[model samples]
Target: MTVVAEAPTFLWLEITGRCQLACGHCYADSSPLGDHGTMSAADWRAVIDAAAELGVGMVQLIGGEPTLHPGLAGLVGHALAAGLQVEIYTNLLHVTAALWKVFTLPGVRLATSYTTRPTQPAMRRSRAGRARMPGPARTSPKRSAARYRCVSA
Candidate 1:
C-alpha cells in the first residue's frame, strides 16, 4: 500500500496560562494567581493571519484555560475572519456567562476538561480511571495526559 502525507488541518494557540483552578496534574502549572501572559490581542491576530496564509483551516485555543484571556473574543474573531474553524479547550468550572457568549459562532466548539489526578495511591486507583500523576518523579506529562483522558471524556 502507498502512504500519503497529510497537511496539518488545525493550529494550536496558547492564549494564556491563567486559570481559576489549580489542579495537581496541570500541564501548564496554571493557577488562579497565574502570571499575566506576554502576547497581546494584536499578536494573536497576527499569528492567525500567518496560520491562514500557511493553509491552516482550524484553530484550537488552549492554555491553562483560554477563557481566562481578556482578549479571547478578538483572537477568535481574527481566526474566524481568516476563514479558520475555531475550537476552545476549557474546563467548565470557570466559564462565566459573559465568556460563554464568545463561543456562539458557527463552527466553534468547546471541549471540556474534567481530568483527575490522585497524589496518593488509593486515590490514583479510583475506579474513574488510571491517571499517570500517581507513580513517581520519573513520570511525564504526556504519560499523565494519556491516562487522564478517561476522566475528560
Candidate 2:
C-alpha cells in the first residue's frame, strides 16, 4: 500500500525573535535582547515560495514581534504575490510605513495581543481608548478607513 502526504493548509513563520518588550507571559521568551534569526530576505522569500508551492492557504508571520524584522514588508509582498493569505501577529508597537502599506493589502491581516495590568492605568483603558493610543492610530482618516476595511474584511 502507498501512502500520500498531505500538504499543510497553514504555515506559521517565526521570522524573528526580537521584541521591544520582555513580557512575563511570553511563550517564546522573546525580549529586546532575543536572537533575531539568521534568515536573510532571500532566505525568507524562498521559504515563502516553498510554502505557496506546498499548497499552504494561509501563512501567519509571528515572532517576539515580526514587525522588528527589516524585510517584513518585502516578505509579506512576496507571500501575497505567491497567492498566499498573510496574517501578521505583532505587538502594534513598531509598525513602519512600509510595513503598514503591505499590511493594508487585500490578502493580508493584522493581529495584536493586549495584556492588561491593573497597576498601569493606561493598560486599563477600554478597547476604544486603546485603539486611539499614540502609535498605531497616527494615520489620516482615509488611511485609517483603509486599515479598518483591511482588518475587518
Best by TM-score: 2
**What's the lDDT for all of these models?**
0.72, 0.75
Question: What TM-score does candidate 1 get on C-alpha atoms?
Answer: 0.70
| Ten-residue stretch with the least lDDT total in model 1 | 144-153
Residue-level lDDT for 105 in candidate 2: 92
lDDT score of residue 135 within candidate 1: 58
- Give the true-structure RMSD of model 2: 12.7
Error of 2 at 25 (Å): 1.3
**Candidate 2 structure quality by residue, lDDT tens digits, 10-107:** 99999988888754345564667667699888988999999999999999999978988887888888999999999999988857787778889999
Model 1 stretches astray by more than 4 angstroms = 1-7, 116-153
- Candidate 1 on 44-79: residue-level lDDT in tens? 899899889878999899987788788888888778
At residue 132, candidate 2 shows an lDDT of 37
Q: How does model 1 fare in lDDT?
A: 0.72
